[model samples]
Target: MMLYLAQTTGEPTGGLAGWAIDVIDALGGLGIALLTVLDSVLFGALPIDVLLPLIGYTASQGAINIGVAIVCAAAGVVVGSLVQYTLGARLGRDRARALLVKLPGIKPESVDRAEAWFARHSTKAVLFGRMLPVVRPLISIPAGVERMALPKFVVLTAIGSLIWNGMLLGSGYLLGENWHQVVDIMGYVPYALLGALAVGVPLFLRRRNRRRKNAATAIVETNTSG
Candidate 1:
């Protein structure tokens, strides 16, 4: 669900976002952190990106401190992401894939691509993948499945979360009353990502199949020679 802030009052006065604002006001930075945790662990559980900028807008109005907001949000994201990673680790690949593929918007193919991406990129996928929208949460699954070092996973997740949070918060602070403009721009991202996936997934599958066939052929030839 999306939260809209009232431009005149600089407060989220209605809807889910407004409810979150009420909580943030009552609990301070910790509230923001908790919400961010929800954002990461549960798909579509909260509109955290939108909420972050609104928090930034609040900071700009002197209602909250920007630095504190950034720290709390980033910390929350890391913690939430860890939960997802642990799920993957504990579930292992086959079980994890079976469960994940059943989630409302999660596609079986997306899981396949995430695993493949991690196979190719290893550590860098954990580091950089945290910044991408579709990949951010999903990437953690692959990391956990591959048994990435806990220390390394935390460090990379923290770094990426900080960068992602800082950018949104900074943009909200700068935009001030006009922060919703960012929301407008973000709305189109899903469509763009869909187009990319539609094209990319097929190509990825073809390459993967070709590689497997080649490996199989090599094995057959080696056995014949023996």
Candidate 2:
């Protein structure tokens, strides 16, 4: 609701979320699809929860067809997930786990749980993981490491991604201007990610630079002691 209102009415665009909404509106289905593909890859992309609904909300405005949005969004996720899956298969368990678990924003516990879940329900893991937050990406890697059949991975990913995309998109389509509330209610991972960026980024840089300052202090202390 706030999405299009900000566009036509005189309301302020609500920061990054606002920007993404506007981009989706401007770019249409293809643009939204590209964004999803980028989001799926290991590279930093906006977020599925945020992007899908925003696009869906815009669809409610009749800017992009909901069907088109779903198709493109799901397609992008499948491609991106396949990339990670391939990498995971190549890296194998030990190396893949070592590198993937350490990535920024990846919780080691979530990765562990995803691995365990994959162990028990390989197909379900890929399907359900498509709908989760951090686990979404993590699950793909483990499936790859486990060398789950590619056909099954593709099928599960497509179905799951489509459903996931539909829910968010439908919320926006149905909720109209109140679509933002859907994101607020269901977008914990997205919010957490935003918080991490807004707060975590600066903190990390400070910690990194703090090492240099401490080393300088240590040099001064050593000279004085000598």
Candidate 3:
């Protein structure tokens, strides 16, 4: 789940992928989680999309427990996502979008689109965006801007991230050494993931709309009681 952008940084550990592997090998589950945290927070990209399969391959060699690795990764993503969401909430949409534009590797169009999408879909964006790349992080921003209920935001992020992370980890576990190093995690997703999304999106939207209504009812009740 953890990876420094090997493509750019030339391995944070040392001279070769060998050293990189050594670091990952030595750290195991904790390493995976930590790496994922950074990646989810925009620190790196190699972790989930590229290194996950490697982690699985190593696990197949009995280097780490696949189950533990998966859990750690999923948890890491959730933690990191919450951080991003909190940041967005604190910054507000305009400030956040402005900051994002100044940051490297983030597209302005992506930010604009995500904010617009959130305006329409609100929580549904949070629920499903975790599985998306640019939208995944930026949607959290708008959710923060709109002041989404924290518990609901985290829960939805966890669910979406779990599905996304689980697929990547499982694919890595299955593909092992044969897995390709995907430079773009969102753009280069596995076919299995695409298939899952095709089926899951509609169902997610349906459930999300229902949840939205229920949440409205809860808010009214809370206000009435107070």
- Best candidate according to TM-score: 1
Model 2, which residues run further than 4 Å from truth? 1-26, 43-45, 184-226
Candidate that beats the other on TM-score, 2 or 3, i.e. the better one: 2
What C-alpha lDDT do the candidate models reach, one value each?
0.80, 0.75, 0.70
RMSD vs true structure, all candidates? 7.6, 16.1, 7.7
- Counting clashing residue pairs in each candidate, in order, gives 0, 1, 0
User: Which of 1 and 2 is the better model by TM-score?
Assistant: 1
lDDT of 1 by residue, 1-226 (tens): 1133444645456776677777787787899898888878875357777777878888888877899999999899899989988999999999999998898888888888778878977876777666567677688888898889999999998897788788788888999888767677655655665577578868988999999999999999999999
Better candidate by lDDT, 2 or 3: 2
Worst 10 residues of 1 by lDDT: 1-10
TM-score to true structure, per model: 0.75, 0.72, 0.71
> What is the per-residue lDDT of model 2 for residues 71-170, given as tens digits with 9 covering 90 to 100?
9889988888888888889999889878866787667787787788689667877886676675676778888898899999999999988887888888
Clashing pairs in 2: 1-177
Encode model 3's per-residue lDDT on 12-98: one tens digit a residue. Answer: 444434454555666878877877787768723434565666666556657678788888887887788777788888998778988
Query: Which 10 successive residues of model 3 have the least lDDT summed?
Result: 1-10
Instruction: Tell me the lDDT of candidate 2.
Output: 0.75
